[model samples]
Target: MMPPVARAQAQVLPGMGDGEMTASAERQLGDTIARQIFRDNDFLDDPVLVEYIQDIWQKLLAAARLRGELTPELDERFAWTILLGRDRDINAFALPGGYMGVNTGLIAVVGSRDEMATVLGHELSHITQRHISRILSRDARNMPLMVAAMVLGMLAAAKSNSRSGSDVGQAVMMGGQAAAMQNQLNFSRDMEREADRIGFGVMTQAGYAPQGAAAMFEKLQYASRLNDNGSYPYLRSHPLTTERIADMQGRAQLKPGADAAMPLVMDHAMIASRARVLSRPGVDVLRVWVQAAGTTEFAKGSPAQQAGMLYAAALSANELKDYGVARDMAARLRERTAGNAPAARLARLLAAEIELSAGQPARAGALLDAKARDRPEMMLSAQAAIAARNPAPMVGPLRDWVATHPRDATVWRTLGMLYTAQDEPLRAIRADAEANVAILDYVAARDRFKAAQDLMRRPGAGPVDHYEASIIDTRSREVDILVREQHAEEKKAQR
Candidate 1:
């Protein structure tokens, strides 16, 4: 149960070093890690939050393409996924084939939307440059020996039950290969410089402040000094040297033209504050943040920023199960922002969630179906409905969402719950299988599909059950194929 930030570096798979891996293979690599994440982490699968981030990613990517920073050789159709890592460390990383993850702490670190975009831009650059692929491609001739060393290491660990022996084996293998193969397992200074350079241009071209990258880096630098951990996650993988910081500073000063004001997207601080709350840091740390940025004693900021702070306080209080405190904070937040604004709507949703958790389902139900003509449609409405234990209002909305977003595992899971409530067990089983498959959990998905098939074998099995069973049976076989393919890849890597 270690936080995502602490676990990230160790989670990177070793010895996938064939280098001639296709774009599709790189995509599978990302999917494999993403599945592990879905299983191990408390993923913030909020539709509103997810869609907002995706919109920003698309903008940054489009700008990169316009500037000729990205090429068609890379997978243009990379199935990009932006995962929200609920960790308190400021870090972000891109997986091969366009999967990127941002820690909540990192979101809270940046001061503006432009800075956030700068971070995303940098990750996009890494993927576009194929830095990871190039790094893994080296020493192809030595892969067999490396894999052998790793296997021996595993055997030693198994025999002695001492993990350190395995660790030593891996270190020896990687270390020797790294020394002989120019240390290509890690990103080089040139790669960092290139990403920084290209990422800066991306932000500028996307109408963000030219200095956004430098500003974000300066904040990171200051944080590095304050924390001074021997292993800052970002520094471990990214290697933020002084030269890179200065290079960004210089480039940032070179503004595009007179239209270089801060970009006016949706309330960026609001998003960051929401991320901070979702990180679920302990009460002690949350208290410190509340003091510095929360609703109380935070009068010297814009209404949006203050709303953000209140949102953080409310969410933290809710997590602590202090419903009254959450209600008060959320009320203040909703009052602070304009009625129809994103911040205001989010505040209302927070309040509703608190009410639901407080066992006031009736009150929460009212919030989910707000009758106001101007009430903005919040993604949390479906979740609120679920929390209220009332699936009636959500079925139509959830169906619509699933119809348009067939691949969203989170929604499929939610829809499955609603189906169970409605006593439609067969459909629920199918939806559950889809959810499992979305994260590439072929084993779990196949099991769920089997359960659906079993349901169809009951004495009262009808035409509809039989029809659905056929589909589920086909899906199970497809999942089996995928599972076998992954096993083949792993065995190949070992060889």
Candidate 2:
């Protein structure tokens, strides 16, 4: 028999596992399975994907703080990824290791950031409780059964295998399998109940109305009933029941002494605006919703409701590319409320974006630079500065920011990209290397290193002897390991 580590490595591919494996063997097997799952799915190694993941993660992280569920320790391992699915199904899922994916369809359905945060918080709880890891570990004891369950679970996850990495069909298939897994899979009913109970707690703690989760589930249930069965993967995998709704209501009511004085955090407007930016049809529709909200029974019902309506309108206009109108509305909002950070930040960012889009890069640079200085730790402002035409000057500020905020891989990646843009290949390579380490993924880091070497080999490029040799040496070692793994697999198959 192979040693635990070797046996684990051998079982890296999907549907292949070491039955009754030791802890080390199980971990190796899990890593192998994860690698195969990612590889077979045609995952892209693009910066845009990385940026999108980082953006969503940051937003959720902030939401976690508002709910008081996030601590420094939790923040370190709480990473997420957004998978763009082509499916029309409104769904999302979170893996045990902080991997949460939001379908484009789900993005369409969510009317506000608060609602999305409700979803994210619920999923985050699953990871925080180590549900996925526990499930996987249990599966390792029964290899065949685990494989079958995983196939179903992955289906529930909405897996895809597309070159563009955005195929909804793949995800739908995965989601379907996941639903099936619930029936025959090994996870206990107690686990589901606990997840529901804890997820509701996280959502309310994040300052969201605990009712949002119940409302969302109700909506999903209604939608599912309206269509044939299995229309929504999320509902299918989650399996909403009357009991689940009652459970949530019970949990929500349990917190009678909850902070009633807590301010209602409004993120709907931003969500509506972002949806508009990403969806052309959604822009006009959201704009109408925003406009109707002002005078409708909804806005006239209450002061808080009216404020939310106005905010949504301003956000809609911003999404429609009506910057001047958006700015005016934002200013009005700032006047209405003394401490409207969202309104102020949105206005500032919109103004900068407008300048950049209008080909006034220098003006954008100045605005962003000043903002970055004022909010020295603001990632968005730092990113805006990095996007400026001559980001060379901003590099020093970015480096300083990174020193203080070392966990932000996006900043490191941005610095590396900026260095490359400025023809500083060596710096770019080093920055990218650091970013990769922060991510704890060698495959990505090795690719960035190769890019740096290629840049150094250009004509009149700086002395590349050391960097070039280093790249070759590092990359060769990585490639050797891959080759060895393939050889071992082949030998095993032959036997």
Candidate 3:
């Protein structure tokens, strides 16, 4: 995994050509490549990656209204990715066909949701304009004629092996004395400017303070000045100059109306606090930040923003084993973000955990069961019920949940554990086997398999061994069949 900065700079070509291509052909090629890349990259399926993309996409769609271009069709076409790069450099990029990669380092630097949104909107505009595709089409048409000239120019710097410098020189020599290579880089600059303009519009429209965009750029410029030229790739790709600052100022001057409500300042503060909590290593440090951010002064700003801050604080306190504080913070957050599904879910889960921690498994079970009625997808309820020294009540909900979410191996595994705890060896074995079959992951499957085998060994567990063995065999066969079917489907799609 490359750092976002390195990945952003890791282009096979210095610049794409400006030639045109048939729209149909371009669309076909782009879709094909995008699908293939998605299929091949396992990282795309990661839960964290999925969540990050969802968050970014939601904000981008809201921002689109500012530009007077909020269409369902356009929203459907937009796609993105967050690349986990190995490099520590802060960077991100967006390609023509909506391929966006954000380095983990860039994630580290982002202190607020709006800051992340600003960058995402800026990159999205480049994709909206189809800049990369147009450049590629241009190169494809001109490559043949320019090959000899390019090679000759490269030969002069062959011994030095300065790839970028040679490419720049070659482009200049072959395209008359117009500094074609510089022009190519400048083209990127122009795209950046356009993106900044469009992104600000989107941010303002989405209710974020328009100044946040400029503030983000200012921070980036400041970072660039503090580091060597190569340290910050964002600055390199999206060069910031004095003129650019003035341009941003001029744009900021054009106001539609002052009545447009700005998002609560506490929103920014809370996001920053959450980012800090997540980034910190030790639970103690997380707790400290949470407590510091949840004081009356901090929570007094914006109700929504304060709610967000409290949520993070509660999460951090929970991680630190401070259930009392965690519960209090969660309750406060619930009051602020009333009726918010995620906040409600978090509060319920935290309350149940607090109860369980206090050794009141019965209370935890009751709370979870009530909440699970509305949020049937919650597996924690079943787990809580099992902890109450009873597995019968959990069986029905687990069965229903499994029916709705058959692909979730964890639920199956938990069901198996619950059954085993209740002394139902055969049922546990079967449930565990089914879980292993669905996931097709041997490591997770092995745990369930071992538990089932252990249960069958009990002296009074009559005929359990035979039944467990049969289930193991059946599930093992199912895994192979599923894998083969997936392969077949992929091959068919390729054709």
Candidate 4:
């Protein structure tokens, strides 16, 4: 069988525009790549982290639109979705479309929202400036396929324990055109400079501290100085230049009150700590964080530092299955961050999560307002409701949510589980199929859709909800067409 990366290259390489790739084509390519990423084990959707990142992302997007940097056509065509990865490497990248990815390690290291915004702004600028397409457009002969292969190869290699995938990627990278592959992987120095300049403006326009750009550059400089140990994968792709650092520093000096230091906000501290814990830093590191919370040094630290420590300690303890420690730390964190609404909400969520994990569904349910419409609250409450054997309350809101957000595979799966709990087999099956459809797994979606149809056709299959039955029939036809198109593409690729 052809390796997945090879198959992907084959599937997407043909009919790619010769000279300049259109925005629509670029979006199509991004969609294909995103679907593969969704299937990758490292791809994740940590609600807290996602919500935090999305806050920064949406601001950047709006700022870009206001500045006329984001054209309506491009904005409407692009995915504009940020996919989170579990990789501990400090990296973020912009794909062909507006799709960007952020590693948990990037969030774990930044000291404030401004710093995170700087990184995100840089990535967003890459998309708005059409850097990827411009590079591919420069020469179309082998560029398109080469870049696609390179992207898929890197993704494949990132997969843990996928030796075959790694081999395929290595072969592509180290092949006869190794130099070309290398060039395609990293943006040119000119493109980097453009991204830096535009990203700085966009970030500041979005109300982030201007010093953040320089500060992030300093962090990259520090990482570059460190003996290469693979902790910072971002440096490899971004390739920090002394000239770039100098430019940012000069820009920072030009800004009013440039001397003023950006303070670390309590919410950022907690969010960073959450990112750190979610990155799966080993038990040794987790234990160290837990111990730090009880130290005299921790007491002497700034409120932000203490907030971070407390958050980390609670999460680490929860990870270690030390529920009592988790609870105590969470409560202290909640108290400490009481002056900061966002941080306090995070602490409350953390407390509720611990309660649920500790098998106290009632406590978890009580911690959250059932009417909360936020993704994190809704998701957590849903889980609690399911565990408590009362999934009814979440069903209505979740159903409404999925109706508008049909691309949310996670929510669909959760709703399916809720249906399962309620013994609504037909709805459960349809939800399962929809979940697969959201991920672009048309084969699996078709199978599930067919199964639903079969179930309905069975003798004495009790009177189903007319609404659900009609919806299933419609979706079944849709998935069948998708599956056939998918097969046609595979055959085309083989040809």
The model with the greatest TM-score is 4
Candidate 1 yields a Cα-based lDDT of: 0.68
Candidate 4 structure quality by residue, lDDT tens digits, 161-276? 65675586675564434345545546789988988999988998999888887788888899898854788877877777889989999987888777788788888988889899
Residue 407 CA displacement from its true place in model 4, Å: 1.5
Q: Could you give me the TM-score of model 3 versus the true structure?
A: 0.51
Candidate 1 stretches greater than 4 Å from native: 1-20, 65-73, 139-184, 224-227, 257-266, 287-296, 369-379, 387-389, 462-470
Candidate 4 backbone overlaps, count: 0
Q: Evaluated with lDDT, which candidate comes out highest?
A: 4
Error of 2 at 75 (Å): 9.7
Q: What is the alpha-carbon lDDT for the whole of candidate 2?
A: 0.53
> Residue 86 of candidate 3: its Cα lDDT?
29
> How are the candidates ranked when ordered by TM-score, highest leading?
4, 1, 2, 3
Task: Give the per-residue lDDT digits (tens) of candidate 2, residues 1-495.
Answer: 011121223323233343332333333343343343343333332232234334545655676666655655545544444434333455666543355555545655664444565666666665555555556555433444433444544443444333234445554564554443345433355666767776676665556665566556666667767763554667655666677777876766667643233333443444333433343345557678456544657535444344455555565676666766655655555454445665455445545555555555666555554434433224444455556655656677778877886655667877877787787767777687667645445566667666666676779875666864675557546644654664675465334
> Least lDDT summed over 10 consecutive residues: which range in candidate 2?
1-10
- Number of the candidate with higher lDDT, 3 or 4: 4
Report lDDT (CA) for all predictions: 0.68, 0.53, 0.56, 0.83
lDDT of 3 by residue, 230-304 (tens): 646777667787877777766655655432433544334433444444443466667665775547776565665
RMSD of each: 5.5, 7.9, 11.0, 3.5
Local error of candidate 2 at residue 182 (angstroms): 6.7
TM-score of each: 0.81, 0.62, 0.51, 0.91
- Clashing residue pairs found in predicted model 1: none
